[model samples]
Target: MPMGCPFLSLRFSLFLSLSFATSSSPFSFFKLQSPSSSIPKATSSDLLSLLASPSHSSSVNPSVADELKSCFKFLVPFTPINTRSSSDFKSPSSRRSLLKSLRDEQNELIWWPPEPVLELARLAFDSGGDPDSIHRALDPTVMPVPDVEGSKEDKCELTRTPYGRRFISQELNSYLEYLFKLIVERGPDVGLKVSLNRYDLFHGHLFIATETGRLGILFHAKEYPLYDKQVFPYYLGYCQKDSNVTYDDSINLRNILWLAPLPSNSTQGWIAPGVLLVLDAHPGGIVYRDLIPEYVNVVRTIYEDDLGNVVVDVNYLNVGDSQPDYQIFIC
Candidate 1:
């Protein structure tokens, strides 16, 4: 188990007020509420249990339970961890101040897709194996191609599109395949298998972002500049190393996928979910051990009541590892 590594099993306890007003919608009570002393503090275990069996929980009000069930129905396809032993898990190290600053700065530039694209994606998922729906969702008009420049020396011949450059139709096809393998067809034992040769498609800047501050799937590409300019330099300075190094020098931002929550909301703060694929981070070295826990801490802190009380299960497969390892964080 990855828990043996110590770093992989990081836990966090975040206390927030749960006093919320009841919404008109049957399951809209998950909305964030004002501070109240009457309600009991909800723990990670409490939320996880509710997700496992929403109808049976008596600890929370029926409205809250219903809302949580509705919000997390998308998680039905994921494998549930029946037994969690936190004895081996340690609290993530203190990087809160640094993360807060990053959140505040990057929150300004967070992006989302148009409503039509999101609707198409939803249609595709709902329609299951319908090729037309899938094609509509993956279409360049619905899914904007990344604005990247390509070179003749590149391994594959690049085709220029109005939005960006890609290798014929391979990029879109690969992205569709990746979505099915990583999310749609995911099962108890399935983990995203990313071949190094097709790293661009498998480990690209594609991510799932939520309006309620949740940044799902992968890291936002807009934050790449933040890391390259500020975060990376600070890390080098902390180690008393040369400060001239860039983020790309240490790890390829393109190859790293971050699944967490946004520090805050975007301009249009309505509750909507969208997929963002920004091809900016150039491929580089492997992600470091310390960085993963840093991201987990960010997720634990930034995730508010947008989706109600929920647990985030993060699984990663590093090069040469026998199998993918995982850790669970409550958000």
Candidate 2:
């Protein structure tokens, strides 16, 4: 529900492109093509069907009741933002309506949107201030930012679009440096500037990502046909409170896989309206049983639904011998 909102999709068409080039017109470049014309993938109706089924009644233990919370890290309770509370903005009615979306829209690009840290970083960069001074001016929690402050102006130039740049004048070796020069040919403001390699998924135990919120531009292929007809796949991952781990993908919970679902941790899986999770499987993955107590219990009853949605129930959180002992992220 704030101003100048940022952060927000992907689909099965991933095999085609990695760089996000928005097609100006309705062209095949952006529009997703179906995987197989016949026997299409499952939609939200499947989950609703499962939930609505008599077999889904309160059981002694849910098929997924024993999962752990350590994986998610927080309880991101998203509340809808409506008309009355949005009258605060001074912009035209259109922009004001956007401002009013502060609550319900669930802007996922805003990891701790209240941090106001990036905006401060932007202001500092634009002001041509020292990185040291800028670093000192920030929240100690997310400090030591990109570390561009004290670097030489000649060494670190502000791209025309504004985010600071580590200019590489040399093109002696591979053209990668040249490519870097070309990629940001515009500026970081055009989109996220974090390193795609820094995505850190293949290297970590748990893959976690969150924002105070982000926009639900489209439904996650896995969680398709969202909760409502107008529903989209907007979710703010719960941050990790116990460990120092951060998520591997974009913090913005917009749909990453545009068409069919991303591969699941199980042999095959489907994620639906009720908390669908893609857990990394490995000793070093984020929700390893040894690392967290509740995770141990969760590993016990975890099963993929007929459609593959993970159905973790509350009892999983209350397990005795392996109840999660640490507080992860604050949803």
Measured over all alpha carbons after superposition, the RMSD of each candidate to the real structure, in angstroms, is: 21.4, 23.0
- Which sections of candidate 2 miss by over 4 Å? 1-66, 74-103, 107-195, 198-331
Which run of 10 residues does model 1 get worst, by summed lDDT? 10-19
lDDT tens per residue, model 1, 39-88: 34344233333433222245556544443334232312222221222221
Highest lDDT: give the candidate number.
1
Q: What pairs collide in candidate 1?
A: 19-33, 20-33, 213-262, 215-261, 252-284
For model 2 the local lDDT of residue 311 reads 13
Ten consecutive residues with minimal summed lDDT in candidate 2? 200-209
lDDT of 2 by residue, 54-80 (tens): 332232133222222223221123222
